[model samples]
Target chain A: MKVRWRVLGGEWQETDTEAKTVGELMASLGLSAEEYLPSIGGKLVTEDEELKEGTEVTFIPVVSGG
Target chain B: MVSCSVCGKPAIYSAKYEGKAYCGEHFLEWFDRRVRKTIRKYRMFGSKEHIVVAVSGGKDSLAALHYVKKLSKRVPGWTVEALLIDEGIRGYRDVTVKDFKRCAEEWGVPYRIVSFKEEIGATLDDIVKKGAEAGLPYQPCTYCGVFRRYLLNKAAREMGATVLVTGHNLDDEVQTFMMNIMRHDVERLARLGPVTGISGQEGFVRRVKIFYEVPEKEVVVYSVLNGFFPEFVECPYARLGFRWDLRHYINLLEEKYPGTKYMILKSLLDIAEAVRKGKGGTPKRCTVCGEPSTKDVCRACELKALLGIG
Candidate 1:
């Protein structure tokens, strides 16, 4: 399956992976589910949320400093 | 699809810490109730009060403002206002400030914006450049943090606010706790809790963290659900601080060890309570700015002198 991922402020890029869930995709990309919220198809979803082919996941960072 | 733990509707969020899932409606109810519970537990507000919400156009701060505004509508004598400190970070603060204005107006909450350039005689960008040129041992965050806190207290006090509210969640609290412990700054640790500062301090406004017990991820979820999530803009200088590194590492631990953040917060509150029961530190007035401080000169004044700004 292919999943498109991007940080909130960055550009989206595509990656082909066999990751089945949000948690798996996060692990595959070296991202921590604790630090970022994955918005799949414009809605925030849980880690167990299933991914479909070419699902766009925007990782919104939860922790930030000013 | 996961079902809502309560109503059988489709669930939008799974509260891992509580082992429950919530639909949009139940989640808001749970979150708002939890926030109110924290307020009640801390005795955060009076019957008639003016709250100055420290907003930065981020999810946490905006959600703090939104929730406070919603609560105030039920109390006739209570008023909520937004206060923003413009640090003059070109790309970052600029974008967030626009969102701040939009939300404040949309919610019908009056707001005040205080700029570092106007108040401190230099913008944050200017201070950073000058500090670098002068070989000052400070990061951009150091200057930004001191000035922002000083200005928020000063502005809130001037606005006759009974209390100042911030959007600091559990993740922030734990990270600061670990940072303070690492630096052996126990005095600062004593000052950390849902409520901060000595009540009725002459120059300091009482500060409360409404989301102190809430996790950062929940804050994001709340903001998104409430439609208060602003454009996600990362501060340009954010990664330069030790805090940025600490935040990432702590989050990693939280991901691996599910309840690590809450455990850390529990320990922090325990230490803070024990220290508070022992004795409170005497507050000193900054001879330069006359703000409450530990030393005769406050950190803000010290930074101003280092940056060669008035």
Candidate 2:
């Protein structure tokens, strides 16, 4: 499966992966679930959710404002 | 693929609370409309008012500043400006101040920068250092929160701003509401609202939260989509306080049960309304700074006195 992941204001990277769950894909991309929220197909997805092929996920920073 | 609820375009955001997805264009439109709705609902300001937005070089504050700047153009006789407070934290604040300045310049909003050292006779670093040396029992945030409010209000008033705006979103507000409830501080809880600071009070600027109802995640998404995103830098002292724990706890709840934050805020507002009707004592002027206070001196003045600074 291919997944496109990107940070806000950063370049998008398309990668081929064998990850089954969202958590696996995030780990494969070296992202922390605590720090980055993953939205799959425009909806927030939990780590347990099964990742489909060619899904576009945008990882948003979870840092709160003061 | 999910399409936008309004227009059948590829969706970029799913507002879980609203149960709707929006494309980039529709999301921006929805975000702006929600902000405008908050303004109108709270009656934050009107035409011929000078609105001062507090920018901390964070995404939330910058997003609030951007939206207010956009909203000002449509409101006749309304003007928008930015205020940045340099807390004088060596590495952390220096970077954000630069980001704030750049955003203000880019947005063409007039801005003023104030510092803790200049206004309160000590930088936050100096305060933390001295507080440790002096064996103060309170945390650094106690001093920072007090002094920041003092400086923001003073600067906004000096600039003739009719309203002082902050980027406090649903998460901040809900976390604060929960913290207050857990502490059982009715006095503080009574003050929580979309709009605060009593009007016609001398030295007190009416403060409004433009993104009060918007979730933190949506604010980040909005900032990114609109190209107004700032550098994500967490305050070094943020995790040292109770609010940090509350924030994470609230985030957990929000993640598990969507719209939990909004429900908390709604409950708080209802409780606040009930408390307001029963509360009667008016605020007194602080003897030291002449600011409104429930006691003889304001919290900022009391903290300053404890720190042995002006």
lDDT digits (tens) for residues B224-301 of candidate 2 = 777766776668888888988777777666656777778888899999888877762476788888877777888988
Separate DockQ for every predicted complex: 0.64, 0.23
As for model 1, its CA RMSD to the true structure in angstroms is 1.7
Best model number under DockQ = 1
Q: CA lDDT of each candidate?
A: 0.88, 0.81
CA RMSD per model (angstroms): 1.7, 3.6
Please provide, for model 1 over A41-65, each residue's C-alpha lDDT reduced to its tens digit, 9 standing for 90 to 100. Answer: 7887777889999899998887754
What's the TM-score of every candidate structure? 0.95, 0.88
Measured with C-alpha atoms, the lDDT of residue B162 in candidate 1 is: 86
Each candidate's B-chain TM-score, in sequence, is 0.97, 0.96
**lDDT (Cα, tens digit) per residue for candidate 1, span B1-310:** 6788999887778877678988889999999999999999999999899999999998889999999999998999899888999989998999999999999889999999999999999999999999999999888988988899999999999999889999999988898899889988888888889998756668889999999999999998898888877887889998988888998888888776778888999898899889867655778899998999877898899988888898
TM-score of chain A of 1: 0.93
